[model samples]
Target: MKTNANAIAFIMEGRRQRFRRWILVTGSLAALACMLCCAMLLLGNTIYPVQEVIRALMGEQVKGVSFAVNTIRLPRMLAGLFAGFAFGIAGNTFQTMLRNPLANPNVIGITAGSSAAAVFCIVILHTSNTVVSIASVIAGLATVLFIYVLSRGRSFSIGRLILVGIGIQAMLNAVISYLLLVGDQQDIPAALRWLSGSLNGSQMDDLPYLAITVLIFAPVILMLGKHLSILELGEQSATTLGVNADMTRIALIFSSVCMIALATATTGPIAFVAFLSGPIAKRLVGVGFSNALPAGLVGVNLVLAADLIGQFAFEVRYPVGIITGILGAPYLIYLLIRMNRKGSL
Candidate 1:
């Protein structure tokens, strides 16, 4: 009786620990995201005080502050925050599900698919933003399907999927380059800007759809967090645990793809926000905890922080994606070297 009681107490204690850890990590991330959002709104060309920024946000017509905060900064900040969250969640889902850090949407040709479609619309069709967004989402979904089908050889292989995705990304990038080379000079700049994953010129009108996508899909991912954790235990183990591994994976992939595609449409690819968020979140939260929300928050922080840096760090303004890419490349190289040494790749 005493042994059983002790086991029960131990299990209860573990649950309590996990719950506390979750709250701490998520709360910290939320606070950080909030701070960055405030900074984005307040620290522009003519830095407004927090009170003025708050007033502007509350629909007060505070002269200069209102116009700058509402018309310019608000939309940009919203786009970065939600899009970063989407990227972070989606990327972490892929990495966690596939058990490979290289399995991020950006690394695996999903964003390339969206970028290719958007570029095509800009360069060849002269399509509007709405059309570009629609085409990008469709292309992203199709790319995932193609990768899944091609990589399925009697069973799913993470190695095969990642390799095929990399190949597709290269091909799609070449296609984008070819289209640019043969297209009108006037459209090149617009296409290039989209490809670079920037948050500049983000408008209120463009934010609702992306926001809706995150709202609708993010919960689905979070709801399936338990299943996602199970998936990390490998397919056979998950199956042994009574988890529907295939269906759960498909559901996760679909939800993640939707979020990522919309996010890419909203702010291009945003460099490696997706790729870097998961590992960072895992490191911060440690093992034996769900890091989905934490990872999303990390992404939000990275995007907002990088945008601020790009805007004010240099004499010449750089895009958020450029800054993130600079930050991500070294990490990518380091990861590859470590993985090679471990013979894991």
Candidate 2:
């Protein structure tokens, strides 16, 4: 009877600790996201302060700040926030399911596929945002399908998938590089900017798709999240526990691809947020559990912070993606080395 009481007390304490951790991390990330949005809304070429930005948002006449903040940065900020959320969650899903930290959408060529297609459209076909979004989604799905088929031999294999994805990414990146080389010099800068990923010119029209995609998949991600956790305990063990291993994998891959594709479609595959968020989430929350919620929060924090840095960092502006890549690449290398050292790869 005493032991039972102690176990219950222990469980209650653990739950409370978890709740406190979640509230602290989630709350901090939320506040940071708000500040970043406001910073983006206010700081720009015309230089509106936060006060004016708020007044403008409140539907008052605030002169130069009003037009720029309302008509310009607000939409772009929201797109980045939502896109980051989608990438973070999707990336976490892949990593958790495969039990591999390198299984993120960006690392596995999904976003690269979308980027390659978008660059092709921009340089060759001169497609608008809508056309590019549609094309990117299709291309992302096709690329992942190719990788899956190439990797499959009656069962899923993590190493094969990662290798094939890296190969595909290299080839597509080469194509994009070649296109840049042969393109009109005038458009090359713009193309490079898009390739680097920026929320520079988003509009209200983009929001409908972004909103619809995240809203539809958020609940699905939550519902199936536990199965992903179960599937991490090896194939035989998961099957023994009555988890449909293959079906779970396919669903997770499909869901992750859709989320990443939709996000890249809207935001031009902002760099490293997808690749970086999962590991950070894992670190923050400790082990023995899924990292989806913290991953999504970290993603929001990364993009919001990067966007703010890019906007206000120095004398010159940098793209958000560039800043994240610069920061995330070294960490990725470290992760790879650690995996190799521990024989985890």
Candidate 3:
């Protein structure tokens, strides 16, 4: 009896320690994200003071500062914040639910769906941004349903889903390439910018849909985080634990698909933000609590910081996606190599 009590006490203490670490790690990441946001506002070409930036944000027109801060940087910052959060949360949700670090939206073709739709609108349809955004969302959801159906035969298989998603993504990429090859030269530049996952020219008007999508669906994913962790334990274990595996997975998939689609539409997929956010958050927050929130914060930090780096880190300005791709490619190669060595690929 005493040994059992001691074991229970030990488990309790470990939980407490994990909780503390989670709080500390999450808080630090949030603080860092906020700092990066501030830098985004203040460290542009002209470099406004913090007080002037705050005043401009507060509706006080301060000589040359208000337009720059409110018109240009504010929209850009908000885009990074909300879109990054969306990517981060959605990526973490998919990874956790699928129990595979490589199961992010980027890898499994959800973002590719959005990308293909947006590219089609830009290159072929000559549509407005609004049309592009709507088409992207519809296509994203459709892609999820399509992949789900194709992977659902003879019991759901993670490997099969991933394989199908990869194949679809390849086909979509070919379509995009064909469109670009035959698209108008004027339109090709626009399509290329969007395809490269840029944050250039982010407008205030383009944000509400993305913001609303993230606001509505992020909480849904967060609420299902416990079920996500359980789902990570395998379908049989999840079912034995009284979790409705199929329903929970569908809910998570739907929620994640929505946010990531909107985000991709908003910021052109912002390369690898979704892919890298989850593992970094998981590493930081350990295992006691859900890492969705931390993952989102990490994502915000990545996007905002990458934007800054792109803006100031070189003689020539690059897009946020370029910076992120530079950062993420190495990690991806490393992950693939490790998985290959373990025969988990």
Candidate 4:
């Protein structure tokens, strides 16, 4: 009885520690994200004071501050914030569900599908932003469905799914290249810019859909966070734990794909935010809890910070995607090497 009591006490103590660590890390990430958001609004070409920024945000026209804050910086900051959160959370969901760090939308062709659709809209159809976004979302859903179908031949296999996704992504990327090659010179620039994943020229009118999608879907992901953790423990174990594995995975995948698709439409597939956010969040939060929120928060920081760095970090201004790509590529190489060493790749 005493030994059993001691074991229970030890388990409870471990839970308490994990919970505390999660809270501390998540709180820190949230606080940092907020700071980055503020920095995005404040430290643009003209460094407006916080008071002026506040007044500008509050609808008071403060001369030079109002137009810059309300028009340019506000929209840009919002795009980075919401889109970052969407990419972060959705990316984390995919990684967790697939139980592989490489199983992100970026790797598995979901973004490529959206990017291809959006590029087609820009290059071939010469469509409006609304058309591009809608097309991207539809294409993203279709791409995931196609990938799932191709990989689900007999049973669900992670290796098969990833391989199929990589193939699809390569094919879609080729399509994008062909579209770019044949596109009109004037339109090609626009398509190229979008493909690089920038926050420039972000408009207030274009934000509502992406924002609303994130707002509605993020909670669903969070609610299923526990199921996500269980689903990571293989199908049979998940079933044993009372988790409806298929239902949970379907829900998670659908929710994640939607948010990520919308984000891609809004920001043109911001490189590796999805791939990097999950592992970083999981590392920070440790075990025994869902890292979805932390992952999203980390994403927010990455987008906002990367945007800031692109704008001010160098002599020539770069797009957000370029910075993130530079940041993520090295990590990808490192992850591959480590996985290869462990014979897990």
Best by lDDT: 4
The 10-residue segment with the lowest total lDDT in model 3: 190-199
- Comparing 2 and 3 on lDDT, the stronger one: 3
Higher-lDDT candidate among 1 and 2? 1
Clash pairs, candidate 3, are: none
Candidates 2 and 4 compared: the better one by lDDT is 4
* TM-score against native, each model: 0.96, 0.91, 0.97, 0.98
Query: Any runs in candidate 1 off by more than 4 Å, and if so which?
Result: none
Clashes of 3: 0
* lDDT comparison, 1 vs 4, better candidate: 4
RMSD of each: 1.4, 2.2, 1.1, 0.9
What lDDT is obtained when candidate 3 is compared to the true structure? 0.90
Which residue runs of candidate 4 sit more than 4 Å off their true CA positions?
none
Off by over 4 Å in 2: 45-51, 182-186
- Choose the strongest candidate by TM-score: 4
Question: Model 2, 337: alpha-carbon shift in Å?
Answer: 1.7
When 1 and 4 are scored with TM-score, the better candidate is 4
Q: What local lDDT does model 3 show for residue 252? A: 90
Candidate 2 lDDT by residue in tens digits, 204-245: 888787778788876677777778888888889889989898
